[model samples]
Target: MTTLFHNLAAWVVAWAHTPYASVALALLAFAESSFFPIPPDVLLISLALIQPRHSFAYAIVCTAFSVLGGMVGYAIGRYGGRPLLERFMSSAKIHAVESYYRRYDVWAVGLAGFTPIPYKVFTISAGTFLLDFKRFILASFVGRGGRFFLVAALFYFFGEPIADFVNKSLNMLSVAFAALLVGGFALIHRLSKRYGQGSARPHSERIREP
Candidate 1:
């Protein structure tokens, strides 16, 4: 699996050298947000490195398509629910996301989108939970846009050094981001337990319980 991802990343990097990289980047971004395993960052960074002047354009394409793909995930969750997600994801992963959705709602989706945490989980969970469509779109735009643009900006300004460093340390960076996600979720859960107890329970639970 590791070797396969590395090969795919290499292929994406080579593709970035071509003129069609722009379209490829958009499509990868779209797919990543919905069901693709590889994130668009691999391609986005490679393309940005090759054409620093077009870094921002690449970021824009990534952000726009990512948001669009998120909507597809959301639609699947809304209309198809767990059966659809189960086709691609494990039951445990889906359950974890459901728990998070019950606790954090929009913030969960936004943070997942912004971080290395798989944003598809939250996008689909938001739909399954019937979260407000407008709120979901807003969160997706803000989080996905910030993350992709940040990567583009770093490549634009720091150039090859950052690119080389990121390429070499990508695994370490993902681990660090994952750590942060775990910590953030722990804190959110603790705070909700302590301070949100007084609030009324979620509607679905309330209906189901009584």
Candidate 2:
């Protein structure tokens, strides 16, 4: 598994230097926001590190495609995608998604977008719960943009030094970043629970009117 991951990472790094790199990054970003398991950041970081001159452009492309993918997930949820849930997800997964959406509203989507959480889950849940489209787009833009841009800037400005640091501390950094992402979700979850006491609605009950 470790060897496979290392080889995959090496391939991604090499791909970043090719013209196809941008295309792959865009697709990865899109999938990351939908149902894909891998985060786009890995590609974004690799591309930015390889070509610092176009870092910001890559960030923008990543952000735009990711938001578009999020909208697709949301649409699925909003328009009878709930039935498909049983096809793709387990009952336990569906229940957890419903619980989160009920408690946090659209902010849950934003939290997932920015953090290490699987963003597709929140996107689907948001649509399932009939969240406001305008608010959903706004949250997706802010959260996804903030994360990608921050990463792009870091790699753009301090490529080698940061690369060395990451190489030396990859394991620690991964754990720390994962913890931070979880902490962000935990904080939002607490706040949402507090706020939801008054008027929270479950996913199954949040159908939009025609």
Candidate 3:
């Protein structure tokens, strides 16, 4: 897995150095926010490191296209619903995400946008639940912009060193992200359990009802 990501990251860096890098980056960001698993951070970092002066521009493109792609995911969930979600993700995964929507709502969208827990899930869930459009857009913008621009800033200033660090720590980052995902699920479960217990009636009350 490490080798695969290293190779992929290398490919992204090399590709970002080409003349058509901007278009490619835009497309990549768009796809990632909708269906693609690979984040645009790879290309954003590479392009920024290579052309530090253009880092902000790279971030802008990433943020814009990513949000646009999120809209596509929203449309899919809104129009296609669970059938479409099942085509990509499992029913259980979708259910967990739905619970998250019930618990966190719009903030969940922002968290997914900036985190490695798969923004696509939240984007689709937003539409699935028919969340307020304006709030969703606002959350996406803030989250995506903050994340992409932070990457750009790091690359723009630290340059090659930061890129090298990210490349080397890719595996660690994945593990950390996974840990976070598990933690989130555990928290949700705990909350649900508590809520269930609190909402339950006493045994005497149940007998009286009968």
Best-performing candidate as measured by TM-score: 1
lDDT of 1 by residue, 1-210 (tens): 999988887887787878788989888889888788788988988887888888999999999999999999899889987777788678898888778778767766776877778777778778888999999999888778777777777788888778888667654655565457669778988999877774666767647753
User: What is the number of backbone collisions in each predicted candidate, taken in the order shown?
Assistant: 0, 0, 0
lDDT of each: 0.81, 0.78, 0.81
What are the models' TM-scores?
A: 0.77, 0.71, 0.74
Candidate 2: tens digits of C-alpha lDDT, residues 1-210: 788767766665676778799998888889767676667877887777777778899999999999999998888778856786567678898898788678767766766677667788888778877899999999899778877786777678887568666445544554465457668879998988977863577755767656
CA deviation > 4 Å runs, candidate 1:
168-210
Give residue 145's error in model 2 in angstroms: 0.9
Point out the worst 10-residue segment of candidate 1 by lDDT.
Answer: 170-179
User: What are the clashing pairs of model 1?
Assistant: none
What's model 1's lDDT at 91?
Answer: 87
RMSD to the native, candidate 3?
8.4
